[model samples]
Target: MGFFDLKAECAICNKQVGLHRFQIANKEWVCPECFKKCGFTAMTPIKTMTASQVQAALQEKEKSAEALKTFVATKKSDHF
Candidate 1:
């Protein structure tokens, strides 16, 4: 069997990747052309956070949001 003998489908375009090779991301097959078009050289997972970690992140975001809101309100009042 030759190198091109292998057959697989591209993950991005869902097309056949026979003669032309494809890229693999997280065990997913992707065509070479589609890989370039999709602009993904590497794929990383963002699914390692636990429930409590997620909640902590959300709380931190809310605190920053509140701080920003307070700063904006003070600035708007000073301008008016």
Candidate 2:
């Protein structure tokens, strides 16, 4: 048997897009032309966070926690 072929047209541009360049979104085969017209592009896949960035974020979180603790202590003393 021959290879099965899937034909699909773009929603916005209505152009026939090959299987390789097609993407499924919202239960439809989104072609490149329609994707560009809709201002949607494939995101560049990357790692979540680097070591230094994670450390910096954790430091900021600690600083915020300290500030919140100080605020709670002052508010408790004010009511007493």
Top TM-score model: 1
Across 1-80, the per-residue lDDT of candidate 2 in tens digits comes to: 11134676544355776664443433345455544433334561112333343335446666877798887443345565
- In terms of lDDT, which candidate is strongest? 1
lDDT of 2: 0.46
**For candidate 1, what is the lDDT?**
0.51
lDDT of each: 0.51, 0.46
lDDT of 1 by residue, 8-56 (tens): 7655456777856543334445556654443334452213433343335
